[model samples]
Target: MQTRTNTFIAITSLFIALGCNQHKESVEPKNGGATEKTIEPTNKVVLSSDIVWQKLNPARGDQSPQAGTIWGNRNGKVATGFLAKFTDGFSSPPHIHNVTYRAVVLKGTIHNDDPKAEHMWMTPGSFWTQPQGEAHITSAKGDENIAYVEIDHGPYLVKPTDKAFDNGERPINIDASNVVWLNYEKSEWLAKDSKAEISFLWKSHTDDALQGVFVKLPKRFNGKLHSTGNIFHAVVVQGGLDYTLPQTNEIKALDIGSYFTSSDRALHSIANTSDKETILYIRTNGSLNIDNK
Candidate 1:
């Protein structure tokens, strides 16, 4: 891949380093005298402040929306998750992306559609997707507009409408009001008795078995989110949560655009101490076991 822009900003080291080291679990002795360091996976949190912000398209470069990566490299040829912040009243000219992507609104409102489409402002908690090579425009009109954008594979690029071509995948624009919500009892990932709600967003067409979901917590909810999978990416989309820090056990308030992740099997401690419910966008290939604290 000769594309330099997509590989430009990568914090591969940071994602592995941002973790909080909780107590290591079940030490297994190594065989044949190999050094035994089989520690259990630890939880990591990337607060809004910890994000390294950069331009989404350095080529377009004209005040392009600022992107803060949560995991993977937006400019690389691998899966990526990043937060894109748009200026108020900002709108892009008709363009197409080199790869498909999914997004969740975290702050303010956004309008993404074909040039001739009606203006449909997607507010917080809304979900949308733009297929690769599709011609479209993105607009932000809120005082502060932010969204969590993700791609399965990237060097996510911005090309002129001339590059548009359908790959047999259609676009989906779902506003917050149109989204369906299910209580915990109806979800396999949440505790049945909890007030938490969950919504399905998407599932991978690849063998990675990746999927996207939105989980909502009731006010002041305290619980542990146990994840058992090879990959997990969680982002704060609405309200806030008190997350335990990796280095120190200090509780940090994670607002919109903040992120956290886990590997293999790990438990993440979270508390929705706010008076309102908090919603999180989770990209994972595992099962979520919500346990009350």
Candidate 2:
């Protein structure tokens, strides 16, 4: 009887040990290494006007080409932002972009014409969108050269839209001055003390992930430090600001045409140290959120 009892005890212990071993193996990381770090969806970047201006290249690879790009790499599957410069009298035949794009006229004047629609003239601060495969022509007006910032998902390609008229869809062209400016006093996403106005330029119909807006901050405006879990890009359209990056305690002085990007969940703040009102053109790839801190 004692020998039989010993065998039974040993068998039960072995089964328990085997079960624990199986559990351990199941709980172990599948990669067979330390858990991989989660990739944050945001990207932090800053591009000054001087730097981008110097990076401009002839769009057609000629000195007198109608269009030029400041910075863009459309060969990859990524989002691209480019500053396009069009010379006076610059024009393009009816063409369509492989990807939908948004543009903010930064300088001079731009005239967009569609064979199936009316002509629309866009000036500085004007914002517009061209849907993918929409046919249109663009030209620079007046003696000044036209420069606009274009943002889109890559790879950016131009194709002749000889049959776009058959689709019967109208393009979007809006002058920023005509858009109603809403006060940020009651905005839930901003600090209660923020004294600014905002004009929404574009919002994606597919999702709230993509949007554009123009913010007007009064002189000496200062806002509390806030963090957002969305990728943000801002350009100084008129005045200057001192932007702070909380993580590194670094401050950047952004002047006119200076651009910067904040990664998702980055802690940052912006202040208009200048005496003049500051206008900022901001774009985001996701919904904006404000941190309580």
Candidate 3:
């Protein structure tokens, strides 16, 4: 708790010294000439359309009769993306992942009823993880197709079953050691040492491009001074934070679920001002190495 308190005060001082101009920056495209535009996205609303299957991209990762891919690892480590489209009322047989599996639902509904008896229904924004040797079954319901993001830990996609669909009448038994949940309630606060081993469900690692990672910060904790890609932004998905600019030694009080972007070439840190934990989803578009800085 003392470390948390120190973190909060440190972030506050950084914010105050930063005044108000440290959170805004202009982003330039990698090839130069073109300027990047920022659009404040609004909440998603469900609507009805009769277009049937929409092939967003030709090639992604792997496509099967019941499963189709969207995007996957393009150039090995530099870029990666993968997605699957499940047909209506399609249920895949129980299968196992020989390698780690990371996936997120883009649309429709998917149920993964392993490790627990309860049926877990995932919507469009849901993300899930399946470790190697973990066996599970999946399916899509209703008239629409189920789309998802998949990132494999190995070179190829591995499954225990050749059939993609299986009826939910009988249960399939397999090893339950590495099974994990992607959707979890944020903790009150997370310390560096107390940080849990979170599963990388689906991560698209792209150099010089923006990547989003979900992180939880415990209450009353201050953050360390760090720099990544020359520019960075932190959005409070939940709770509030008292932020600090490391270089300027200024601080400011930000409310719950607010948005803050760092200034150009400004060293920065953050703290949790609320009693509850702070949850943040961050995206950065430049080199993340800060050793020289």
Candidate 4:
């Protein structure tokens, strides 16, 4: 009887020890490893218009050109953004950028001329893409200063090319009014109930690494809580929206001219709570993949 009792106790203790070990493993950050806290990198940032205005400075190495960086270090290999303001009647001699760039005209008129090709006069809300190694000249018309937002990868340097330019290809320029808006409800990537509209601006010819879109959300519209494994830089072109950062549980009211950047794979949502439609100029680095949840 004593042997039977000893056996029962031993079996019970063995089970208890096994259960404790399993519990410890389950609570640990890694499988069968010691418990550790995971630290996530800060991947979200907001840049209000006021902040951008304060950061405005003359373009580095350029002769007195007003500009401000929105996000990412322009000197780094990652994608970067800048808000450039041109003086009235400003014109540039034929030049080229080392890296391709996409631009959205925020205010005033911009006249783009390629000596070897046709000229395009772009007004506010116009979108254009300047391919790398393509030489072109830019000029600002009208009495008011012209402003535009430029997004690109690598350093922002202006290389002066010879007056002799190539007529091989022309820059892609699209007026905002001429762009066709596609309903977000019909898109396979968006939530079925979403009431937003999107106007695609430009997609890189080489790959999906660079792309730009103009999104318009009606009042009281709620976007899907989506995540893309690409860094997104967005600027509020008109109206306002309430942006929610799911991980931090923080809400921010993005007014016109407000800018924000989301780290790769960060989950977030936007809602147009105002009475007017909210327009956002969104640019992404890397391919944009939408997660339903």
TM-score of each: 0.83, 0.69, 0.37, 0.69
Residue 101 of model 3, lDDT score: 47
Candidate 2, residue 33: how far the Cα is off, in Å: 33
Best by TM-score: 1
The true-structure Cα RMSD of candidate 2 reads: 20.0
lDDT tens digits, residues 157-217, model 2? 6777763433333355656555445453433344345567656555556654566767777
Better of 2 and 4 by TM-score: 2
Clashing pairs in 4: none
TM-score of 3: 0.37
What pairs collide in candidate 1? Answer: 6-75, 6-76, 7-75, 20-246
Q: What C-alpha lDDT does candidate 3 achieve relative to the native structure?
A: 0.40
Rank order by TM-score, top first?
Answer: 1, 2, 4, 3
Q: Model 1: runs farther than 4 Å from truth?
A: 1-39, 57-62, 245-248
True-vs-predicted CA distance for residue 259, candidate 3, Å: 23
Encode model 3's per-residue lDDT on 86-184: one tens digit a residue.
656655566654444444444567665453335556664344555555556666775554443333333434456543333322222111122221222
lDDT of 2 at 184: 33
Best by lDDT: 1
